[model samples]
Target: MTQIIRTSADLRDRVAAWKRSGILVGVVPTMGALHDGHMSLVREARKQSDRVIVTIFVNPMQFNNASDLDKYPRDEAHDLAMLEAEGVDVLFAPGVNEVYPDGFATKVSVSGISEPLEGAFRPGHFDGVATVVSKLFGMTQAGRAFFGEKDWQQLQVVRRLVEDLNIPIRIIGCPTIREPDGLAMSSRNVRLSEAERAQAPALHRIMTAAAEQIRAGAPIETALEQAKAEILAAGFHDIEYLEVRSVEGLRPMETFSEPGRMLVAAYLGDVRLIDNIAV
Candidate 1:
């Protein structure tokens, strides 16, 4: 039976017992509304470690829009049931006050790579990401942590945090799990209206095609400009960015001499979708 832990002391006690027994631990951090994409991480953790801890906290600090934060999907009972089926050892579902209580004053900020992309569009986003993630690292204290590559830039930011802060856990990035039509799986996808959902796969489709053309010798700027046009034509509004960038720093790339990535974020009606592909 999977254990449901809601307090840091209870979690640390369980972790201590696992430590004493020399069992390796892996943790998957999530904001609930469990889906197959989140399960993929749990499965990977199960495969690699003796114990798996799945955290279900919708970190309020990360949302740029207060309404967006309020609307973020959360179904903990469903999430817990899914984890139980996956053989997760513990479900760390802490209250917001537990994670960020009164007198909480510290924030973790990673400069440079985080300043662009999502950071540029969603101000203070990565600071929230870095802060809560750093706290997760401390709270779970697992030997390994799993993150999905769908949030490619976020992965780099976490990796930088682990290295720069000398955090002991190994950050393992799993390949993005996508829907049959290629829409990247996200908790927010649940809010997409049916019409928006049908049109959502185009984001991935366009990015994939753009990456192929760029790889096949198309000019980088031209490929990106065409992608923006395609997204706009597809009825996406508030198109935040569509550019090819160096995978490491997210710096825009004009020449595709080395491996690079094409990242995009646009709104399909009210739902914002982001996707990336290799070039």
Candidate 2:
């Protein structure tokens, strides 16, 4: 039975009152289609703070394709039920008008790290993520915020933004949740037809294999090529990008760096899926 705060003013008022009463708040930001991955974040937030705030905003600014934004799933009633069951204390579900009333005149963009891989695929995507996240951090005044490690690069960008902007909230990255078949749990998974869902696990499987190859002293270029071959052979129509980068700064690597990650994005039919595995 968590209260839903749909406006910035209401969120600030509640958070300010909570602060006066010494209540520590934790936040989980999402784009409305709540799944097990999102619930995991809420549960983690519940463990660390007196109250948990879950924001459901599709964030139009983050989409490079207008159709992608239009096609994003949204079910407020179902999402609210899931949040309530997970013990979330507040649901900040705002309309686009409320969150970006000025038609997005300004945005937050990070240099260096924001211009590669996912950034290259969807231009200005991180800018939208950073801007909306900054607004959420300010509105909720969260003592801590929870994010999934599935979007590892995006998590890093947020971490940098928090540090550079001197935001007081502690950002915690939760582990990536996955299906029994090993496919990373995602809201977009719903868009996959039955056969596509069965084939989607190949992305994770390939990344896992690539990580093993790197650990076994295989050449980075050869391992990546093998991984790409594996995915392509598994019926992935388009391989957007598959790369191994240093975990610290997400820079591309020519050799295995001991501790890094394999990042992959592919299109199965029309649905775009992304996944990563640590090396």
Candidate 2, residues 40-87, lDDT tens digits: the string is: 999999999999999999998899999999999989999999998998
**Which numbered prediction scores highest in lDDT against the true structure?**
2
| TM-score result, candidate 2 | 0.98
Instruction: Report how far residue 270 has shifted in candidate 1, in Å.
Output: 0.9
Residue 118 of model 1, lDDT score: 95
Show pairs that collide, candidate 2: none
Q: What is the lDDT for 58 in model 2?
A: 94
Per-model TM values vs. the true structure: 0.98, 0.98
